[model samples]
Target chain A: MSEIELDLISHLSEYKRIFSFLTAEDIMKKELITLTPENYLSEARVIMRDKRISGIPIVDKEGKLVGLVSTERIIRALEEGIISNKIKEYMTPREKIVYFSPKDTFEKIVETFERYRYGRYPVIDEHNKLLGLITKHDILRAILKQFHSIYIHDRRREEYLNREVSILASDKFIEDKASFRYDINTQSISEAGEGTALLKKVLEKRGYHRDFIRRVSIGTYEAEVNVVIHAGGKGLILAFFEEDGVVVFVRDWGPGIEDIDLAMKEGFSTAPDHIRELGFGAGMGLPNMRRAADRLVILSQSGKGTRVEMVFNLKEGRD
Target chain B: MKLKEVMNTLEAKIYTGEELLEREISFGCASDMISDILALAKPGSLLLTGIIAPQIIRIAKILDLSGIVIVRGKEPMEETIAKAKEERVPLLGTKFLLFDACGKLYEKGLRGT
Candidate 1:
């Protein structure tokens, strides 16, 4: 097995109880209102409105949960012009339910929620009697805790991309003949890498050929990766493909780089020590971008942000 | 060679895409780096990777890879497998390490074009 696979396996095994850790009885709201199958549609609506709730469980005369009535069903009924006063006409008879015992863990709850994508789950006792409701908000809080753990675990990964890359100056190059005008936001460079890939796909979808797409992908990938790794999470990238070429604009909100000459030096990287351990920040990001792009420009203001624009010309009638 | 031949050569298990065993793959690249695979691998090539990320299937979609071989007994996440199925990309798993798996295919005359 590769080291990465082993690492992933270990990680999965370590977090086996992620769902269990997030579920608990306290997260459920026990003050649930019940309705009968014979209740009027308007009556259910009034109860929902008064209770400030979107749904209510339907119970039989024995107080056993039998169905569910929600706002969506009411809207559908209105759309279908169903003026029937019976709750049975609108309630979901075969509703999905989630039941949790006192011994059930938070990880299981999270797993169930993610698998089902349900807004709410009803917790029940050993006898399968509904005791309370656990809404999506409770699961979201648990997921947020997982995010926090991941963020802390990857702090070094975050710090590597928190520096500034120099922005080269450029005269405004705008084209009026383009089909679409895309305003590049260079302020959020962390997203540039993924954005560039998306832009290339967008161009190809519009009938750009393989070679032009490849060139744009290469240029955008390097520029965006640089923005993410060096711009301190404060760079923006905007791109649009035109009839003649692809235009890319990148901006950053870091301390303006002092020496473009030194910064662009082939192997010069100001990446912090921890970034090197992760196998990135070798300073080739900018040079690679320069090599791939046809025209490159940079603009910067100290303590504000840097903007870098690049254009890749395509062969006319080559689509 | 056919996909069944490749599977037999490597002693791979078919996780899904069983009906696609007759599909032909002329070449393969074994890499865990998704970016490298996206930038380097050719269309219709078989991908051998130990990395189990959703992006693996996403890259396959973008590049139009024929199949994915998750080596080292690694299984893709459920969502990733579902995507492969949706895209009609054959997925296989094997207990061999990446290098050994690639070497076995290379020895069987599956050249990287």
Candidate 2:
């Protein structure tokens, strides 16, 4: 059983406690069925069949999730008559797959399933470390368990789950001062918005002004995108929500900026051709990120890493 | 103003979510970029754009925009229409360009939030 389930089963007597704070970390598959890049496709196919799963998470020697081999990849491999190929030869690169982390809200999971309509997603940590696996079934099952037992079998339980849970963040779960961290992978457009999107909900639930949230969202997004587009290695975003506003720090273990002054100038870009082809790396990210934040400070060590700290102060009243 | 009046003013075709035409809207924002829409536009504002892709609908849904108007008589692809229907965002097509759509909506008392 997952930790959350254990917590729930133990807390059955006091089930009136907030069950909606439940997140992906509570039930993700800890004993993950994963594959290494060097693994053979035929062996992977057999393991997936035996496990009754349609996809296999691919990890690196460091146990970090580097790619995935889905049933679609399997079919494509068979179509090319290369069942003997290595997992890396057929797996979807890490940058392309849509994934969520353990801290992600159940609402975000539902939105992802509805938006992308994918069957399953690998659950990883901020460092690209594979933690567990999650599917639509897993989410629905966990959420359903949160009801009835907690609310004394009332119609309001149905209304709360059906209406408020889906439409907005649970107002009952708001905390004034909270913090969280997220790991960002390289080159994954799908995962680029994860941190910013999740942060928006935190700010929204606290009744932060829309324009304040927008500035935070915009600043966080550009920082996230910069990590994916240029950070040769992985990155991390640390978010702190205080009583007045929020502070975000984006740090990456990639080749740091050789010239901070030049990089900050609008329309000055060093992004390669393929990244440009993707319609990003237009040299505007740093400037935009700066423009959206109330206070922006950048610290970098060339050939080492870059750290950007941004502050968003709330207005006296709603904007 | 209700979306139907905006549709009439722009002479647009309803591509999806016809039932939502009765929904009221306050502001209009014109942009072809999803990032711009996501970062700038307010929820319940009208999105006037030339880019008619599934992504536009996704942005509108994420930002909780009131509806969309695909400009220059262009139609959103079938896939885009299907996603818009699922997302419950009304889609309108207008022969008028993006600037004209924004201008007319502005004259009618709409402003970007």
Candidate 3:
């Protein structure tokens, strides 16, 4: 292999080792709200809204994580006028899912998040039985908790205090980023990437690196595809350019995602066979968006709409 | 290998960018799925697909692909050809099936990305 490739592998393995000390069992949420495939989409939607959660794990009689239903599926069903349909018709089935075992280390989970960009992952046993759920926030909390102990032991209190002050002071200098908005017409799948293409051009004109532009385009394109395939084919794209990164907010007035947690799961798609035939609806759209963006947030209301926000942090000194 | 060699190996016909046949190509990938191409394809790799829409051409541009091969003797739409030309991406066609086309290229040492 080439030297650069070898260097990357070594760096990745070293990074993995640093976080391998903590496993999924250490940080996953043991308590979870779950449903069965026999449940109706309306029921799942109600549960997600009332519980203030974005997803629900669909379990079988054995409590296996057989499927998942989230707000994206709910919004899709609503758009199709099938809100009353069985959850089985809308849930992302188990075969396409990516799950983890309790023994999986934080490094593996972190790498998976970086690659898939899912909002949360289910921790299952060898038999595929649901155990707990883990999110990026949970991982952060665990890391922070670890740091607290390290700080207590190292006697680096003054240095830590000074670092925190510098971080807050740096935030004050970030000016209000310029914003741009565009109307997305999802009338045709062939035209789906246009909105993001425009964004790409704008970024390129500003002299951003091709790799950075590629990342933004991929994330924005996936968001655009979601709007087209699930959001009744009409939406809006809002972007803000920051000195260090870019923020994108994709909005749609169609049926909102009723359970976002399920929607964020990799391979959890609600698209029909027709859309699938076109090389889409593989349930990787959201994950792809997540993988490309440094951070992602989804907001939705059942009858109102859904808005997806993604932030991309650019590497310094590359441009 | 040059794209010209790939065309010769598959008995392909150029739909556009005949002047650019001398471009160097090192990798190949076949898929009808756009997401797969977006996620798996490497820069400058050649795409083998049966899809005939203008979207593929747009994707070719966005991903910086070397070119696209419309396999299975299928022809791309006029709009697709036009877009490929506008984007300066080579568009080619082959009478060989997708599998056979890929096999022929692989035999000639063209590897996948």
Better of 2 and 3 by DockQ: 3
Residues A4-57, candidate 1: write the lDDT tens digits: 533433333334333334445756777789888898877777787788787787
Q: What is the TM-score of chain B in candidate 3?
A: 0.97
Alpha carbon lDDT of residue A49, candidate 1?
A: 78
Question: Predicted chain A of model 2: TM-score relative to the true chain A?
Answer: 0.43
**Local distance difference test values of all predictions, in order:** 0.64, 0.72, 0.78
Q: Candidate 2 residues B41-91, lDDT tens each?
A: 777889998776565665564566899999998878787798789878899
**Counted clashes in each candidate structure:** 28, 1, 8
Q: Compare the candidates by DockQ and give the number of the best one.
A: 3
Q: What's the candidate order when arranged by decreasing TM-score?
A: 3, 2, 1
Lowest-scoring 10 consecutive residues by lDDT in candidate 2 chain B? Answer: B31-40
The DockQ figures for the candidates are 0.03, 0.05, 0.35
A1-319: candidate 2 lDDT, tens digit per residue = 3456444333332322233355778756677788899999998889878998878899998889899888877877889889998888678899988988889865566556556655568888899998888875575566565432221112234555564232212222233333867788746553466677677777789887777877787778788877877785389887787676677878798887777778877778887776554435557777777767766766565665777777677768654
Quote the positional error of residue A233 for candidate 2 in Å.
Answer: 8.5
**Model 1 bad stretches (over 4 Å):** A1-170, A173-194, A225-235, A254-291, A296-306, A316-319, B1-5, B14-26, B62-64, B82-90
- Who is ahead in DockQ, 1 or 2? 2
**What number of backbone clashes does candidate 3 have, counting pairs of residues 3 or more apart or in separate chains?**
8
